[model samples]
Target chain A: MKNFEQRLQRLEYLADRIKEPDLPIEEAMKVFEEGMTLSKGLRKELESLQGKVEMITNGPDDQGGPDMVPFQEVKE
Target chain B: MHLKKPHVDAIVIAMGFPAKEKAAADSSPLLTVSELTSLIKGNLEASFPDVTVEGEISNAKLASSGHFYFSLKDENSIIQAVMFKSKLAALGFAPSDGLRVRAHGAISVYAQRGQYQLIVQSLRKAGTGDILAMLEERKRLLASQGYFDAERKKALPRFPGRVAIVTSPTGAAIHDILNVLGRRNSAIDIVILPAPVQGAEAAPAIAKRIEQANRLDIADVIVVCRGGGSLEDLLPFSETVVVKAIAASRIPVISAVGHEIDWALSDFAADLRAPTPSAAAELVAESREVLLRELDQFQAVLESTMRSKLDALGASLEVFSPELVKARFEILSLPIVNRLDDAHEALVNSIKGLLADLDHWIALACSIIETASPQAVLKRGFSIVRRVGKTQAVSASAGQAAASRGGNEIVRSSTGLEPGEHLHISFAEGSALADVREVNE
Candidate 1:
């Protein structure tokens, strides 16, 4: 998640840089390509995200850490 | 004690039973206190086996054994009531002094005290009005401590990697949250920290689960939620423990208790108050479609900006291209080229005039030379003569003969000429040999 946010920030920055009036064409093109790649990767990641549901067990493990297991909804 | 005797008779009369008449005392056998008390206890227990009484509670106390002891009172009367630990545990809200409640229980006589009391099996707030007033007082107290201060609230993470929900495992809230979160963003991992969402035990259990979620530190945010319920059913969410737990959480909390109209103290203490469990999930998880759309917008902006930049660059390049440069260069160098062309024409004309003058001079010189040259004179029928015989010296022939052949010299005059000397003569077209008879100077 942190990486995703960072990537998004970087992409936005690139987009902003590309819009700078005085930027050289070569530099602008480089930034534009980077922005395009970052956006593509972010889109793919968002599309591929799979959700998972789990429940914390009633008691902690021997190490006093939480134990999680897939949650099954009991149907009435 | 005398006042209670008539009240006891009134209660027995209300139950459609005749009281033991003190007037029949002379004819009847004297009854012991235990016997009489046992009889009253049996009668009371049987008559009011299952009853619900609405009154204000006073002197409420929870014992160490978890029994709740209180008195239910109306404007004119009061009755002692005790809810054992088991039944007390099932209460939706805490029983407190000054709180009005409807107590459901059986009435039994305490023989030791020679009085009858209610054994409450369950309890609920008498009405919403008193509960709201109590809630208002609690809210003020908690507010004074800054439990609902905005400054203390932490901002929720934009993209939560994991969300731990503190709610009932079996409640509709859990299902709604899961459905909404899953539909919006499947990437978020959910961890259910199960707790009873109602009853007297709910408050502590919820607080404990929230604390436990913090201890685990596995989720980016904690969502405390429950489906809509009656005011009493949602009382636990307004409990001090639950509100304090939400305020104390290190992780940001989102409170989504009951429906949109239901407001719990937890909502105030939490970082964000969602109208419903589904809304809480929506707040915590970013929708994939919305994110993708935003990305698309960024991409479009990037593409369009780059296109225009390239187009502008291309336009500038066209200005510098050969054709355009040539056109501009022509405009700049036109005068210089015209001046060079004029200079070249003038130079060619002057050289031609100089060559003509030289040609004229050469022709004139040729005519002058023709007038003075020996060859030109010879062409005019002049003849010259030279001696062909041997002659060693002939100074007199200097002007007459230009060349000597063999031993012969030309005789300018007849001086030094011998009678036997042969002479060679030449005219413009012919030459002849002859003997000279005379040489006169």
Candidate 2:
């Protein structure tokens, strides 16, 4: 898990690094591919998180009403 | 008198010389068919400015030399017509029997046949629908092949390096194209490759010039154009040769054939099609003012881009300066020192643990020494005594008595008996060496 997290962080860093102008074109292309992977992974995680929240919100409520607030108001 | 003069009554009834006067008054000249036809021809020419006659084309024959002889007939009337080969070939479509046509010319008599005929200067469909029918199939074929597709059409050069114009040298189209191009972009080179544009050989000549220009790589783009004319006059431009030449050209071809409403095959095949030659030149070459404005914009963009690049480079240089690097190192040094201090504490703890182990070993050594010490031997009732002048032990009782009498004395002292040394005798009560006895060795 820690190794995956480290790899994810490194990929994000590389994505940001490729934004710099002087990067070699070949390396930048590789960075773009990696960035795409990271972006896809992050989107998948976000979608899953959203799905979980949706499931919880739709589950066994006293009534299906707009009266209740969803998850925490803030996250770090 | 009435009966006898019945025959003479007729003579009497008629007045003298009255019959002769009536005959003279009724006198008139007679005319033949040829004379009347000449008169009608003269009259019709004076009466009508131009006449169009609709009829079915029949008895059509083109002579081996260079003349066309055909007849135009309606349901009842038939009239002979003649079109010389030069004009017949220029007609584009062949005139044939049963084809309905409207002939534009004057009515006149051919003296040889003594027949009235139409000397047709031009001919076209009597109705507009036939033209549409003729063009439909071609349009469908070209459309299916994607020749008329907007996506396949090339975007005309924004600024052509050099423009080569293919048009008739003597026509108004060349003048119009040159005038527009000159007004729009005077700096652009305009090379005109003159072609006939309207005769039997026009299509092939135009196609050849296009191929020549393409092979020579003379122009960045080409404009094939001619002035507007009647549909038949524009047919040369619509020929398959011209269309294929346009399609095959490597350089972009702009075709401006006729007026806006007139579309030809060349227009479909061209990379860019304009309504007129002047418009085509305008499309490929921009107005001088628009070009100047674009140049100004490009200059501004170039200056701004270079400035931004330089600024970014300078900013990066400042960020990577040695002083900044040193400052960054100093900022991070404290944490590294703190980490090192933590490591030092760990090492000190380990050293303290080793010292504690050494202290335990020292305590064990002390205990062992206590067990093996001479003081322990003393506690065990073991004693070491020395003779007066020698390290000898007095053990047996008789030996101790004998030593006391002669040369040795028994003593319970740290010293032992020695030769020529005096010693005090000590026993359970007392012992002493009183005399010396010489014993056998």
Interface RMSD of each: 2.6, 32.1
- Residues B117-162 of candidate 1 have per-residue lDDT tens digits of 9999888877786888999999999999999999999987666778
Task: Report the lDDT tens digits of candidate 2 across residue range B1-441.
Answer: 445434333432332323433322124223365654565556555555478888888998989887878998987877888777767766746677666788888776666676666777888766645555766677677678766676767666554656777877568777777677556544555666667788898899889878877776657788889997666678777777887788888888999987776678889889988999878767755533454454344334434544555677679789879999899888889899888999999999989999999999999999999988856765676542223332333334444544545654334543333344433334333343222222222
Give candidate 2's whole-model lDDT: 0.64
Give me the candidate number with maximum lDDT: 1
Q: Over 4 Å off in model 1, which ranges?
A: A58-65, B1-126, B182-187, B284-286, B364-441
Candidate 2, which segments miss by more than 4 Å at Cα? Answer: A1-76, B1-133, B136-159, B287-441
* Candidate lDDT (C-alpha), each: 0.83, 0.64
Q: What's the i-RMS for candidate 2 in angstroms? A: 32.1
Q: Identify the CAPRI category of the predicted complex in candidate 1.
A: medium
TM-score of chain B in each prediction: 0.54, 0.43
